[model samples]
Target: MERSLAALLVCVFGVTTGEFVLAGILPAVAGDLEVSIPAAGLLVTAYALGMIVGGPLLTAITAGRPRKPLVVGLLAVAVAGNLLSAVAPGYGVLFAARVVTALVTSTFFANAIVIATSAAPAGKQASTVAKLVFGMNLAMILGAPLGTWIGEAFGWRATFGAITACCAVGLLLVARLVPGDQPVTRSRAFGEFTVFRNQDLVLAIAITAVANIGLLMVFTYLAPLLTGPGAFAAAAVAPMLLVYGVGATIGNLIGGRLADRALLPSQLGALAVLVVLLVALWASPHPVVTGLLVFAAGAVGFSVIPGMQTRVLTTAAAAPTLAIAVNASAYQVAAAFAGWLGGRVIAGPGMTSIYLAAALATVLGIGLSAVALRRDRVRVKQSVLR
Candidate 1:
């Protein structure tokens, strides 16, 4: 890995840990803050709203700044935000702090991807992005668990302290390693928005948002699905989620390599397989089968992400940072929508119906990918005639 990429990896790991660690600590947060667990859960919602609304807007606002300093500044703010969370006086204070911290998450991520990809060797951008994505994987696999352990051992506030300390280390690494003279495109804020007018770019962004809904939806409800229909004990939830996370990490790396070789084809295959896995999950065939499929579903589901990000970056190279930030926002939008839709499904049909709904939702992603693939062929043929 490039030195800069490694540094950004640390940054990604830290910021994402902050985002994800709340799940394990929410009950603790509620008890301390004198709020209901569900109310405390709104902190997650606050962060998503921050990422969704803040990412593109903040990236565009900082578009004129030097890349190196921008990332450093963002991470510094994140460190402070986490510290604030650690010492927040009440739920309201903690909520605002989370939003503030989240405001920088997507912008930092967008800049980090651009920095890493810009330094990548030819034809290796997607894989490079995948490497950066390992930070998120590590956040899920290692950081969240460790943070949860710390919270349990100390307090929920201590979890924030640990995350803050990690962000500070990431901040130092980023400043030392990332080049001082990293280039910026320096486009006007409003002008960057014009990239959205490009139909292909819009489609790439939409594909990312649409394709991820089912995966996030199911993941959000994995505990209930596993316990209720899969007939697994509550004790099984943690280990099963661990298996899913491991599969996701492996899939992300493979997907990166596949995307580097053949972007759309790999994405199409992954999505198709994911659709099948979701349908199979709906069957609730057996505990063993369900467990295996959980892992496979995670692998296939996340395998599409690097390609999705690559497609967005490819389509909007002139405004890659803004485009990717918007892409992240779109993903958060999908997550929010997926949660809402999943709730409706749970309320109406049943818990098991989530998988069926998920599979059907993924079919839309397949259609979009197929259409994008066909257009690529048409564009190539036309260029040949010309």
Candidate 2:
């Protein structure tokens, strides 16, 4: 079981790297593709759009397949997609490759989460999920900075090529280490929607979306934001991102433990921290202050992931795989919307607009959580009465 989890974590690291690696190298991509920086930023939107469409669809199509092979197959596809990206001749080709890559990436998350939670010891679902998600934080820590440096030193294409190699290594490790051959029970495509009947599930998803909107709005354009006002030199972006990555790792670990003890409180506390961090991030302009705020933003921003995912999974226990897939899709939808919204703000009201807008979005998320908590209490009281 430990080996399986380790393999899944490595696999997740590769996919997560693919997702956020673009952020650090956005400017390099824009220059290479002869497009505007915002245009390059839209690559994040494109990938998110693909995940939005593919998460449920691919999960439905591949339902009941043998689990281990399914993961390996998806990783192979990711390898191909990244390879295409590495050799893309223009913006259009790279855009197509990103969409294709995201389809596999979203499906991989659904499968891997189901596998991890199932293999986990009793009462450790959130912790196990956090462990898998640690790969994402790790990617942010290592992959994003390394990819950024590679893009600067070599070229953006070289960054993709390096990711391609990582995906291949992940593919091999999964096929060898993840021990599973059990086939899922055949499931109808439409059955995935049954989880939505529960209002708690719906509310949990909404919270996820709203929270992400706040994080990604500022995060998607962080490279430029750091460089814009001489807040950091061109060479300093990677180190700043590395700092954020470290904070993210710490937050994810603490969030998992807190959620295992009390889901609602963990989420609320994280959001509260985020509100403060976003304000500081916007108001502070000094290099030291901005760097510290960036690290805090990363820490506070990601601390709710385990709680949020655990809430959705428990609420939709009847359709765990599909529900997990839907939550993954929700994240992508949030990313796509936030990335596009950030681009629009960057174009019009200027870069500073993103932090303020993100802070307001987080306040809305807090309101949604209050409503959800109230509803949960009412439901519990009714159950006791019955």
Candidate 3:
């Protein structure tokens, strides 16, 4: 990878750490801010909402700008937001700061991925995108745990302060390293929305939304599930999470390779594995079994992500920036839905229900993938007949 792309990867790691650090340090934030845990939890909701609303909108608005400077500006927003988070005196200020940071985070993801793919050598697009996303997976694997430990050792404010410093470094690296490219063409922001007219691209978006909902539904409540029935010691949670993260990283690389060879089959196979693993996790009570299943779940679930991302790029070849931005927004939409639905399921039906619910969502994603595959076959047939 180029030094510039490596910097972008580190930038992604920082942004993703910021996104998930709140989850690991929620109790500290709640206590420090004098809010209920549930209320403090709304910070996550606020961030996801911002991503859902801001990603496409901001990407469309900046569609014509030079990507390098745009990325630097977005990273500056992240730095400011995190700095505000580090010193916020009330829940409302922190909430607003998180929203602002999330807007920058999502828009940055859209722009960064476009840059990664654009800068990649011929026939290696999926692999480059996977490397970029691997940074996010690394955050889940290590950064969140470290941030949480810092919060416990010092304070939640300290965690945000560290994140702010990280963002500042990322900003400098992006500004100095990423190449500046002039606009190829210019159009109204509304014109970007026209990519939605493509049914294949829309299906790709649905796959992202549904698959992520399923993935996060289980992940958002994973701690309780691990300790509740599995009877694992509290100390074991972090290690188990690491195992899952490792699996996720492996799956991400595998998925990229598979997508290059066989996109449709790779996605189908991954979702199928995910559905089976979710069911297995629900039934297994042993800690070892649970840990193995958790790893497999992460592996299989994430294995399809690159395929879904690349699908949007291929299908919306003419408007990949908007399509990919919409794709990122779809993930945020799924996250919001997963958080709400998982909460309801945990409250009403109990914790195990979260996995079952996620399984159902994955099943839907599988159905959608099947439909997309069928459509591809028919189009191929028509081409041959013509």
Candidate 4:
């Protein structure tokens, strides 16, 4: 149990660091590559797009195979991608490297969730999944800030180098801890799509996507938001991010417990909190207040992720791995859309508009969650009657 948990943490830390380190180094990348900041921002978007595409595709292709080799292979690819970026001659090559790494990272992330949940003792599945996800939030707290500091002090390429080292470490851990034999209890990859046909699962994914859209809309522009007028200085951005990470870590732990106790209520409460917090952010721009709200937003938004995953996994019990993988893909796709939306809103109105849009999306997500809960209750009653 300890080894499996450690392995999951290592994989998640590596992948999350690789995925989010870009956000902290965007400015440096822009200057180094001689591209406009917005243009350089495409690196983040490209990576997200890769995840959106890679999650389901890679999972389906590797269905029923031993997960260890696939995870190690993906980590190797991530390391290579970061290395390529570290040495790439120009923006184009760096962008390509990010895309490749993103695809590999997505596979690793989805598989990590599957492995974590499957390895957990039956009743403790949510908690196990939460521990794995905690690594992701931990990356935001520790990895992103450290990457930002390194990129600022040394250079953006140094951030990639750091991620490469982390990936190497992750590969070693995975080899040692992950089971050598493939678990072949289920070979129903195609049937996993049946999860989509289930209204509850469909609504769950839809709300998950909507919630992420709002979350990422603000997240993609968080550095800018913090560094803007009346906000924190550029140097303070990392610390603020650390606070957000704290919130996310708390959320991950609390969310798992909440889901284990009462899944739907936890989901609804998290979404509602997110909506309120985002609206508050839109209304207030004070650095101290905004920072707290940002932390709250991270805490509330992330709290739903584990619960959502649990819901989908339960709904598609026969093919939990595929269901979880597809849900992971939905998250990235929503992130891509949210980033684009933030860019659009930033272009039109300004940074403040990003939060406003996010707040609106959060409200929509809350409504979706409410409907899902109602539907679930009705289904439960029907099952009891039958």
Give the number of the best model, judged by TM-score: 1
Q: Is candidate 3 or candidate 4 better by TM-score?
A: 3
Compared with the true structure, all predictions reach lDDT values of 0.93, 0.84, 0.86, 0.81
Please give the range of 10 consecutive residues that has the lowest summed lDDT in model 2: 181-190
**How many clashes in each candidate?**
0, 0, 0, 0
Q: Name the regions of candidate 3 deviating beyond 4 angstroms.
A: 182-184, 347-349
lDDT digits (tens) for residues 15-41 of candidate 3: 889998998899989998899999998
- Sliding window of 10 residues with minimal summed lDDT for model 1: 182-191
lDDT score for candidate 2 against the true structure: 0.84
What's the CA RMSD of model 2 in angstroms? 2.8
Q: Put down candidate 2 lDDT per residue, 186-207, tens digits, no spaces.
A: 6676666766898888888888
When 3 and 4 are scored with lDDT, the better candidate is 3
**Preferred candidate (lDDT higher): 2 or 4:** 2
Residue pair clashes in candidate 3 = none
lDDT of 1 by residue, 250-331 (tens): 9999999999999999999999999999999998679999999999998888888888999999999778899999999999
**Model 3 score (lDDT):** 0.86
lDDT (10s digit) by residue, model 4, range 1-386: 67977976986887788788887789889988899999998888888788878777776666666787878888888889989998989999999998888876656776777777776777777777788888888888888888889999999898889888888887898888878764543564554555567777778778778877898888778888778743678888767777888998999898998888888888888888787888888887577888889889988888888888887777766556666777887888787788779988989998888887998888888788888889878988999999
lDDT of 1 at 350: 88
User: What does the lDDT read for residue 348 in candidate 1?
Assistant: 99
